[model samples]
Target: MKNLLLIFFIITLIACNQSVNKISLDIRVDGMSCSHSCAPFIKRKLIKTEGVLEAEVSYEKKLAEIVFNSSAISKEEIVKKIESIADGIYKASIIKASTKETNLKKPSSLNNRESLDFNLTKPGISHSSGFQLPNLFSLLNSILK
Candidate 1:
């Protein structure tokens, strides 16, 4: 009976840790209009954070979903990073972080998505025409400070 109890406890701990990996937030951004221009900066910042395994930013939905190791990080820190990255261009806040999965894609496959369209010649943020990421990042950084 003691052995069974120990096994259950171990399993419970693992399960709890696993649940900590998934996080999502809804960010209110001022300058974000499309995916191409704004997403890469946000993605870069989130993925570089210690525990984050995956980070997805949606311009249309104005949301950022991040998957990370709970043991190495916390929801509060993630929120701070989002706010920092978004800076003056965007305002970020935690909508909620639950065991429920918000984003289903893995980080390795992010490049394959149809949303990344920095090569286009569009002037604004929209569905068909992507924004200019490099320029936008500079603009956003300037605005942030």
Candidate 2:
């Protein structure tokens, strides 16, 4: 019985595997004076946002580079998420955002779907939040100062 279940699970993982489409966002954020203090705050928020796969913020450049699923989230929505943080204190302006579908060939056989390169996550935040992350700009300001 265990062997049968394991085989079924393995087959399910194999059947569901497919190429992914990715979108990249480059945003220039205003009202940030320091990178170390502000960028982390921005990154923490973006990573928590729905549809965001990976996000990097550079305070020195006042820019945010985010990778996400365009089909699931739009550029406008991403900007809204950014601005929503700190009660609209951070002004986010888009420099450019583009998307492309990846067309890599599927491997002849996948022994383990878990071993494949995957940074995917479900879109949106859960009610529990899983962990607490700081989103305070005033305290950050005081610490930086």
- The candidate that achieves the highest lDDT relative to the unseen native structure: 2
CA RMSD of each candidate after superposition: 15.4, 15.8
lDDT of 2 at 17: 55
What stretches of model 2 exceed 4 Å from their correct place? 1-19, 100-145
TM-score of each: 0.52, 0.56
On a 0 to 1 TM-score scale, where does candidate 2 land against the true structure?
A: 0.56
Q: What is candidate 1's local distance difference test score?
A: 0.59
Candidate 1: minimum summed lDDT over ten consecutive residues — where? 128-137
Worst 10 residues of 2 by lDDT: 108-117
Report, for every candidate in turn, its global Cα lDDT versus the true structure: 0.59, 0.65
lDDT of 1 by residue, 1-118 (tens): 9999896576555444443344544444445657787877777777667666567777877777776656567888877777676445657777767655565455443532233434
Q: Name every residue pair that clashes in candidate 1.
A: none
Residue 89 of model 2 has an lDDT of 84
